[model samples]
Target: MDSLSEQQQQASEKPIINITGEKVALGPIRRDQVPLFYRWANDFNVLRTLHIPRPSTFEENLAFFERDVEDEKRRTVVHFTVYDRASLTPIGRVDLEEINHRDRRAEFGIEIGEPDYRGRGYGTEATRLMLDYAFTGLGLHNIGLYTWEYNLAAQAVYKKAGFREVGRRRQAKFMGGKLWDIIYMDCLSTEFVSPVLSKIMVPDEVRS
Candidate 1:
């Protein structure tokens, strides 16, 4: 898929929000953005830790994009485009997946596709915006995520964003001929009391 194809998808489903911060924006992904998303997601380096099947065609990406933006099930998965605030171009994605309403939890994931965008704080800002949406806009009680043990950079990002390690899955991933454990981390609204209040207001803030 080319850039034109992505523009068309954006017209069809438009983003849910264009969250603005000092460095980046977390916006709703329109369906037209599917092609760009496909390329980023299918990159070998990007999909190294993701669980979805490898997509081989633009059509597969289109189908996935529609499902992600339209589905409203309590356990539904949602994704947002991480865009540069100044240029308004998608540079990566942040996702809240594996949501369980009864359990009041979901798994989070993020990636910066553009090499130049890495280490510039876009991931942190995008994640903060997404977590605000999950905990406040969606009324979720908890959000969680897992990362490969060696992904220390990601762990640091999650920690700075207020997540705490909760558990670890032993030898869960066999990649590049080696076994690796997965680290599970999570954050609760109750825990957000002081640190994140200025960054993202809780739902009660409005209600109160």
Candidate 2:
């Protein structure tokens, strides 16, 4: 196949958006996109920010995707493929893991694997949309995340999206010949005002 045709074919297979913001959209993880996920998993630049310690094989990523599907069915985790809104390009992923309905809490994680998309405000917007879904759509009360101290950029984004530093695990992560603290931050439903879900949750009668 010609390069242009292949590109067109790939474009047609883009995942449909589930949740959207001004700059980014969150969509279901498509089975066909496991290869893309596998690519991200092995990107050392991306892995440095995330908790992944070693390179992952394509088969391992496939197995992980299968397990992830089962977890979604059990409602133990919620994952989304992050897309660039303007181009509808798959750029990364975001997820709420370890969800406990009784406790009303979960752990948040995000990675903008596409180097081109890094440093943009997309991550911050995506974080807000996920928080809205957790607090309002899913009725989750608290969302927490852990970031290495070296990941100052992620910490800034989390703070912008309403998370506050609850505590820290000192010198927990060793990388680049140095030890970095693991920063724990969380956002409470009471402290956040959902940008999207709030409007949906309001009574129409009240508006009238």
Off by over 4 Å in 1: 1-17, 51-55, 73-75, 193-208
User: What's the TM-score of every candidate structure?
Assistant: 0.78, 0.90
C-alpha local distance difference test of each model: 0.76, 0.91
List, in order, the clash count of every candidate structure.
Answer: 6, 0
lDDT tens readout by residue for model 2, 4-34: 9997687567667878789999999887789
**All-Cα superposition RMSD per candidate:** 5.3, 4.1
Model 2: lDDT of residue 24: 94
Candidate of highest TM-score = 2
Task: Output the number of the lDDT-best candidate.
Answer: 2
